[model samples]
Target: MTIAVLAVQGAFIEHEKKLEHLGADCIELRRAEDLNQHYDGIVLPGGESTVQGKLMKELGMFDIIKSQIKNSMPVLATCAGMILLADKLEAESKVHLQTIPMTVKRNAYGRQLGSFHTNATIKGIGEVPMTFIRAPYVSQVSDEVEILSVVEERIVAVRYQKQIALAFHPELDNDLRIHEMFLSLCK
Candidate 1:
């Protein structure tokens, strides 16, 4: 299956590499037109949500991605990408691609120095090591969303049908179970 990674900024390249290592065809998504290409799934990598949001507007991708999610396309948003997918953003004012009904607080894990890794039991993926780098946490989730993983009692990973929002960087870990689970959702 083909997976498109939003390459506007952030850890998109890393995500691409992980997907490729999983034997899935991966592509860098730049323009809104790129979304027109056939793809089974999409990944929004961790980055500055404000900047990425602006870039999406500049590249005319904001609406297209929103539409795609509305059409039931499978998507995985990691870290800042999770902020983008959230229905409510508690940071700077910007247009977020509200794909998931959740309220997100950017940098909920403190500053860069607060970044750390830990072993967590992720639903459907078992116990896996996760990297949280200035990550955001899900403050609230709708009834449709399922809590996939948690750390210190906060929601770290969640899924709403085909859409997955992960607060940590699964791509940074050696385990491909999360990515593999996402691939399975594509099928």
Candidate 2:
């Protein structure tokens, strides 16, 4: 299957490497026209949410990608990507894609100094390595949202329909089960 990795900004290259290692063809979505190509799924990597949001809008790709996710296209959003899909932000007024029915708290773990790594048990995947870098946790979720993983009693991962949002960067770890799970969803 072909997957589109948003390369506007963030750790997109890592996600691409993992997907390729899992035997999935990947396309770097650098511009608006890149969306025109067929992709079975999309990966929104960890990055600066505000910057990514602004760039997507400036590039005229925001609405189109939002529409695709709204149409049930499989999406794997991590860290700031989780912020993009969240319907609401705890302290921020601006919402990006707003496709997932959940609330997120950006930089809940503080700044770069707050970055950390740990092993957590994701509901379907068992215990796996999770790397959090200036991550955002889900403060609340609608009935349609399924909690997948929690760390320190904080909501770090959830699945809403075809969208899987996480506060940690799974790509940074050696584990490929998460990416495999996403590819399975794409299939």
Candidate 3:
């Protein structure tokens, strides 16, 4: 399968590496036109939400990604990517994507120093080691969304049909089960 990783500015390379390690073709997407190309799925890696949002708008990729999601493209968003996929966000008044029906709180896992790793039973992946780096938390999810994983009793991973939003960075871990699960979602 061909997977495109948003490369505006983030840990997108990590996602690309993971997908490549899984024996899948990976592409780095930088502009709105890049989205026009065919791909089985896309991954939005962990990064600074504000910076990514600005870059997406500056490069005119915000709308293209939204349109793709509307068409039921399988998308996996992690960390800052989760913020972009959320329908509502706290402390982010100007930059909000509102794509997924959920409320996200940026840096809910605390600052960079607060980053940690733990074992969580992800819905499909099972007891997987997850890395949370200045991650956000899903405060609430719409009825259509299904909870995939949680940390400290807060929703960390959720899926609305083919759209998967994860507050933690699955690409950072050596395990490729999550990426494999995403690949399975591809049409």
Candidate 4:
């Protein structure tokens, strides 16, 4: 399977490495034209949501990706990537892709010091290491959204249609189940 990683900003390289390790061909999407390539899925890595959103808009990739997701393109979104897919933000009025019908609270875990690591059970994939760095949690999700995993009573992962969104960075962990699960969606 082939996947596109949004490399304009954020921790994209790590996701690329992880997907490649899973035997998937990865294309780093650095420009709008990169979206023209044939890819089965896309990965939105952890990073500053505001910067990533602005850069995507500036590069004219935002709408293209949004349309793709709307048409059922498989996507694996982590950390700020979750924020980008959320339809609403608890504190901010601006919504990015608005593909997932959920509300996310940005940096709900406080500052960088609030970063942490733990194990949680995903719906399909059992317990796996989760690394959170200034992560955002899902405060609310529509009836169509499926909650995948919860930590400390907070919703951190959800699946909607062909999209899998997470508040933690699975790429930061050694576990490959999550990445493998994402690749499965490509098939």
Candidate 5:
């Protein structure tokens, strides 16, 4: 299966490598026409949400990706990607795709110095390594969103339908379970 990793901004390379290691053909979606290709799933990597959101709009990729997600295409969104999917963004006024029914705080962990690494339990996925770099945490989730993982009493990972939103960077770790889990959803 071919997976489209958003290369507009952030750590798309890590995600692309992870998927390739998992035997999935990975494609870097650098432009709107890339979205026209037949792909099994999409991966929104960790990066600057504000910049990514802006570029997607100016480049005309935002609406197409949003429509695909709404169609139930599996999506694995991490860090800034999670912010992109959140319906309500705290501390920030802009709402990007507004796909997931949740509220997130931008830089909830403070500045870059607040970045950390931890082991957390994700529902059904077991314990895994999580790396957070200027990450945002989900403060509120609607009834439809399932709480997947939490660290220090704060929600870190959640799943809404086929879209999995994570506040941490799973691509930074050696554990392939999270990527495998997302690929399974694509099937």
Candidate 6:
């Protein structure tokens, strides 16, 4: 399974490493040309979603990715990646790809000092490690969006069709279940 990981910004390297560790071919997508390669799925890592979206647009990769996502390309979006996929922001105006029908509140956990770690039960995946660093929780999800995991009664993970968005960074943890679950979507 070849996976194209967006590497223009954020924790792309960590994601690439995890995917590789799972015995999947990892490709770092740094430019529009990089997106030309054949890949089974995409992984959007934790980072500044706004910056990543801006870089993607500037590099001419945003549209292609959005289209791919719309067409059912499996995606594992974490942290800021969740924000990028959200259709709306709680109190923000800008919407990135807006592919998922959900509302996200950016930095709902206060500042960097508010970061934390915890274990949560993903609906179908069971218990998994969740490392939240300046994460954003899902404030609302449409009927089509399935809530997967909740932390402190807040929506921390969700699955919509072939796309899965997590408020916490699974790649930052030692658990491979979440990543494995994502890879399973490719098959």
lDDT of each: 0.90, 0.96, 0.88, 0.96, 0.95, 0.94
Error of 4 at 132 (Å): 0.4
Q: What is the model-wide C-alpha lDDT for candidate 3?
A: 0.88
Tens digits of per-residue lDDT, candidate 2, 75-160, equal 99999999999999998899999999999999999999999999999989999999999989999999989999999999999999
Regions of candidate 6 where Cα sits further than 4 Å from its true position:
none
Cα lDDT tens digits for candidate 4, 69-182:
999999999999999999999978998999999999999999999999999899999999999999999999999999999999999999999999999999998999999999
TM-score of 1: 0.96
Give Cα distance to truth, residue 36, candidate 3, Å: 2.7
Q: Give residue 63's lDDT in candidate 5 (0 to 100).
A: 96
TM-score of each: 0.96, 0.99, 0.96, 0.99, 0.98, 0.99
For residue 78, give model 3's deviation from the true position in Å.
Answer: 0.6
lDDT of 6: 0.94
For 1-187, candidate 3 gives per-residue lDDT tens digits of 8998989899998898888998889988898788778798988889988898888889998888778888888998999999988988876665556778989998997899989999999997789988999989999988998999888999999999788999888888889999989988985
For residue 149, model 2's alpha carbon misses the true position, in angstroms, by 0.5
* Candidate 1: Cα lDDT at 44: 92
Can you tell me which runs of candidate 1 are displaced by over 4 Å? 91-95
For model 6, state the Cα shift of residue 96 in Å.
0.4
Predicted structure 2, TM vs. truth? 0.99
Off by over 4 Å in 2: none
Clashes of each: 0, 0, 1, 0, 0, 0
C-alpha lDDT of candidate 2 relative to the true structure: 0.96
| Candidate 1 lDDT over residue span 41-156, tens digit each | 98999989889988999999988888888788899899999999998877656549988998888999899998999999999779999999999999899899999998999999
Question: Runs in model 4 with CA error above 4 Å?
Answer: none
Error of 6 at 4 (Å): 0.5
